[model samples]
Target: MTQRHIIRRVRGVDTSDGAGVKLKRVIGQPALDTLDPFLLLDEFRSDEAGDYIEGFPEHPHRGFETVTYMLAGRMRHKDNHGNTGDLGPGSVQWMTAGRGILHSEMPRQEEGLMWGFQLWVNLPAADKMTAPRYQDIDPSAIPVVHPATGVTARVIAGELAGVEGAVRGVATAPVYLDLSLEPHAAFDVPLPEGHAGFAYVFDGASAQVAGQELARGDLGAFSRIGDTVSLRAGDAATRLLIVAARPLDEPVARYGPFVMNTPEQIHEAIADFRAGKF
Candidate 1:
């Protein structure tokens, strides 16, 4: 049982997206590109109203999944399919934009801290054009487990300690866990063989993996061959998001919100969107 170590470290970049909302782009940026099945990871945390009031206007997405996890504030979302929902604190929405979909996400509050994360996951070529779907999970629906004495884990996708997450039956089998570790606490979990894993530290002083330190806003990518990944909190408490998924290993052609297998498909997607097709 070899332990996985951080093979690379990438710091988040401060950027603006979705109607001028400021966010930290952890993936899909210059420093670090896509992570196989995972395309982008954005962390939006701001107390100012001007930063997030505009929110994300109506937009179209094709051939991927968008996961919105809220830690604070509220967000209202509606899609062209007549689906509407609210994401309060601790809520999670897993939206699969298989073929195409038009949606908008706006801040429900006028002011206060708005903290959340938006993760873009890539769909395989076979399922890229499937029908769009969503899994809106409430806070109470997510399972919280104590894997260690000073550790708490919120299982969002995949399984932990024999407990399945709220999300299931996806093209890419993914594991998404929000971990909180007290001082000196350690967490160890076994990852599937050949799966890509990443850990993003959001809170606390720092975390250590394989004797290397991952500071706040730093993302650590694990070695693919290791079967297990271990994390140890520093002097203070730490909070992080750990995600793993099987890679598609296919070619990726992306244009803004559209993602496909080739340039011709990308051109087709652009034409479809321009012609009032989702």
Candidate 2:
């Protein structure tokens, strides 16, 4: 028996920075509830300096992890911890905003196109106030391997090509990957037996997942599917960002950067941040 994939193509709106930086947000603020503990996802790819130069200036975040993966150009980032670095093509930075932190991502667009995606993953209630941490992974460190079907995969948070990523993250058992399928090629991505997985297609020109159809800018959220995801590309090569999150099975109460199980917990996060606690 084949179960129908309940898929939704969410057309995200365009948002402009006060500094005139333009980008598309798949999930944020108003879309927060839809993403649960995950607060937001932003895609900033631009050839014009005006569209990205503004960058995300100094901002505060707490109770989550922000994963920034660059596909092109460069991002100069600095945080309150005095940790500063530059992110170029294929680089990944996962900053765990356990307690609180202030940081900014400034564009160092030496090339024409500055492209990247930023995703916020929530922390479990017990670890919300652990500490602000980071995993600065360079492109060379990421696994870009081809196991089968002429498909190359970038392992970030899980296993691909039997080569897992080097990021030592939380215990939720999440999986994040950047996959590229050669024309007419196909492959299967392994996931936890009962985990939740989804594919976000930035270019929907020609792509399909787990026998389910998907278009550009579409998020194909899987239901009670199998453990592996089968994918194929069209005439042109296809690129997709795949992620699987563990089911916390707990209440999710969120307010901006703070994600807790209760309103008062969120309020405490705010007060703690204002008290210079990070």
Q: Itemize residue pairs with steric clashes in candidate 2.
A: 204-216
Q: What TM value does model 1 have?
A: 0.99
CA lDDT, candidate 1, residue 111: 93
lDDT of 1 by residue, 1-278 (tens): 88888888999999999999999999999878998988999999999999999999999999999999999999999999999999999999999999899999999999999999999999999999999999999999999999998999999998998899999998889999999999999978778878998999998879986568999999998888887788899789999999999999999999999999999999999898889888
- lDDT for 156 (candidate 1): 98
In candidate 2, stretches whose alpha carbon ends up further than 4 angstroms from where it belongs are 1-6, 17-20, 29-32
Q: Rate the local accuracy (lDDT) of all candidates.
A: 0.93, 0.76
Error of 2 at 178 (Å): 0.7
RMSD of 1: 0.8
Over the stretch 1-278, how does candidate 2's per-residue lDDT look in tens digits?
A: 33324344454568864256687877673543355445677788789887877787987887778899999998898988999999999899989888789888888864499888888887787887778888999888988888786688888887776787867656567788888777788876777765665688875366868776667776766664567777877777778888877766667777766777788888887887788876
